[model samples]
Target chain A: MKCARCLEDTAAKVADAPDGSGAWEIYLCSRCNYSWRTTEEEEVINPEKRDPYFTLDGVDMDDLMVLVPVPPLKK
Target chain B: MGCMPACKFKPLNNKRKNQGVNNLYRDLREFLAKLEEEGQLVRYTDEILPEPDVRHICRASGDMPNGPAVLMNNIKGYKGKRLVVNVHGSWANHALSFGMDKDTSPKEQFHELCNRWDNYPGEVKFVDNAPCQEVVIKDDINLFDLLPLYRINPYDGGYYFGKGNVISQDPDEPDNLDKENVGIYRMQVQGKDIIGMQALAFHDISIQLAKVEAENKPLPVAIALGVDPVLSFIASTPIYYDQSEYKFAAALNGIPQELTKAVTSNINVPAGAEFVLEGEIIPRQRFPEGPFGEFPGSYSGIRKQVRIKVKAITHRKDPIFENLYIGRPWTEADFLLGLNTCVPLYRQLKETMPEVEAVNALYQHGLTAIIATGNRFGGYAKSVAMRVASTPHGISYCKNIILVDDDVDPFDLMQVMWALSTRVRADKDVIVIPHTPGMPLDPASEPPGMGNKLIIDATSPAPPDSVMREVRMVDRMPQALEVEKIIAELQKSAGK
Candidate 1:
């Protein structure tokens, strides 16, 4: 399955419903790390139905900036 | 207008039981019971989706001025789990968190909090056993199976623990109890046992993490979920680095805070928390984190943040997962961070300038602050505004400062507008300093953490300034107070 946000095929099943009723399954995209459940609404699970502002299509993974730069290891 | 005889009315404290200071709650369950008793909590038992339904209801609650805290009992996918949001959304609920009367005004609550600020560094009691440890999961722990996680905003990248209080001690001074920090930072669920935390550069956790990273070692952290109401408030407060939040929580509630040690680490956590995730922040490790809806009513761009590897998860049976909904203005984030932001700034300002009356830093966690102070000299108000920009929390968060007269209550926007409209001469009253350190979550920051600071001096000019000539002010008639008393009595009788 392709991720709804990044449109990558890195989506893989993370967990299923704890009740063992086959109710829902959670999927996480390894590329962009967007996680969603199958039972969620179309806007959150389906790529076509997601908001355009949040979609990461055609975005470069290396372009994201680091919020806090990692400091050097002490000698 | 004719003068009326002076009515002998006592002060606010002399009238009631000091606004119910003895009603200290120990846990979220106790606080929820009190909220339900006060008609400030609402329960929805219908089965609902975790995504849009819960977020939509919480956003709608933010639209209401006096919305009740919502408790959803029956979620479709999760069978026995429960979720509560907006517990600190409205002024009424915010007042109830302090054990104050539900009808207490925000200004009165602000003053009460300020009055309690004098009693700093209260005691914390360590207990042997806690309910949070009733059920422990150390092997093969999965967050999705435990927490009823859901996206708060439609554009959020993933589910977030928006209200968790992260407790950590300084790596350099691990034995110093006063240096222990309990703060609220946004953590997103990346995998079953992995969490991505946004420890901003200015936050206390970042300072501790930096020290640990210098030695290339993991920083121990304990994430406390569904803490007591007062603990949530104190966690979000930006107090001095050396001050302990547990002690502040005790002082604010006029009682001692209860704490317990985590299973894997010596870090003390609130014993009343519903769940505790004992983890270690892997030093020098960064991963993609955000696009979460921030307090500034904007979506933070995706950035590489630190990752936490959970070692264990402990919780009380049938735990209620608490989350905060933050989007546009006036959401639960505003109320949660409102007066806690004000009291520290007010206390710091009073230390140097005793003439400062009150501070209203309710907007966006004090990116903008409204201060009321007395004019000691020609440009005293400007000096007060500059001092506000230099305080510990003010350095990064306070970008806009509005100074008004002591007579004008900073909590009332109408009075502030009147002062701004009548007293401010734009050329002389408005001052702007360029390239100041600012909060990165603020969208207006050019380089994400650097921006300009603005000060609007709305106080009346004293001697030698002479911006205005022969200013005449109108005073309220003595009969007005008598009329107010009469109208209050009439409204009470009519049940208005």
Candidate 2:
């Protein structure tokens, strides 16, 4: 399945209902880290139904990533 | 505008003096019971989808006048699970949290909270056992199974624990009670046992993490969920770095806060909390987190934040999961942080400037603050505004400071707009200082954490700075107070 936010096909099934009920499944995108459950609304799970404003298509993931520099270890 | 009569004010409901009951709730369930008894909570037992339905109800509650806190019991795919939202979403609920009359106005609540804040460093009672440890999961810890996790906003990257009272201590001063910090930060459930926490550079947790990371040691933490209402409020408050939040909670409630040691760490969490997830922040590790809707009404961009590996989960039987819905302006996030935000700024300003009357930092967590103060001299209002920008929370959040005459009620936006319309002269009243420290979540910040700060002095001219000609101000009629009292009596008799 494709990620709803970034349209990436790297989404993978992460977990099922702990009850082993096959009631719902959670999927996480390896590319953008977006996670959603199968029971979510179409707007959240379906890429086509996603809001364009939140879509990360054509945007560089590196540009959006904020890497806070780790402070140096004490000597 | 003419000021109202002083007779309109109602006597504060001082529970401590009248009934000897200080609004100290032992647990979230006790508070929820009080909310239900007072007609401030709505419960749903119908089976509802986890997504959209829960959030839509919560979002709609913010639009109602003093909306009720929503409790959902029967969520699809999750059996015997309970979730609550908007627990502190309205002024009425906020007042009720303090055991005050539900009709208490925001201005009155502010004064009551300030009065309680004066009695700082209250007592804390340590305990050997707590209800939060009734059910402990040491192995096969899965957050998805433990929590009824659901996304608040459609664009949010993952389900977040938005209201957990995260307890941690300074690694260097591990035994110092004062150095222990209990704060609330957005925690994203990244995996079954992995969580990503947004620990901003300025956050107290970040300071503790730095000390541990420098030595390549994991920082133990306890994220307490469904805590007492007052504990949540005190956790969100920006107090001194060394001040203990449990003590603050004690002071706010006029009683000793009860705390218990975490299962795996020395951190003390509220003994009455419903759940406590014991974990440790992996040293020098970062994980992709966020794109979550923040209190600023904007989605904070994804960032590589500190990662935590959950080792255990302890909870009361059938624990209730509490989460906050933050989207746009005036959600539960606003009400939760509103008056607590104002009291701090008011105290800081009143310390040096006695003429400072009131502070309303309810908007976007004091990104913009409206301060009412009596001017001591010309440009004194501007000086007060500058001081606001330097306060602990203000350093990063107070980007726009609006100053008004002491008579103006800063809590009332209409009164504020009147001052802005009549008192402001663009050329002289506006002061802009660029390239100042700001909150990164602010969408307007250029470099994320840096931006311009603005101060608008709306007070009338004092001695030595008369920009406009003196005009006689209109005053209320002498009989206005008597007439208002008569009308109030008539309305009461008519059941209006």
TM-score, structure 2 vs. true: 0.94
Error of 1 at B427 (Å): 1.2
Q: Model 1, B292-359: lDDT tens per residue? A: 99999999999989999999999999999999999888799999999999988988888888888889
TM-score, candidate 2, chain B alone: 0.95
What's the C-alpha lDDT at position A37 in model 1? 85
Q: What pairs collide in candidate 1? A: none
Candidate 1: residue B189 lDDT (0-100)? 94
- For model 2, report DockQ: 0.56
Q: What ranges in model 2 sit over 4 Å off?
A: A1-10, A19-21, A52-64, B1-23, B476-479, B493-496
Report the lDDT tens digits of candidate 2 across residue range B373-396: 888999999999989999999999
Clashes of 1: 0
Off by over 4 Å in 1: B1-11, B491-496
In order, the interface RMSDs are: 1.1, 2.1
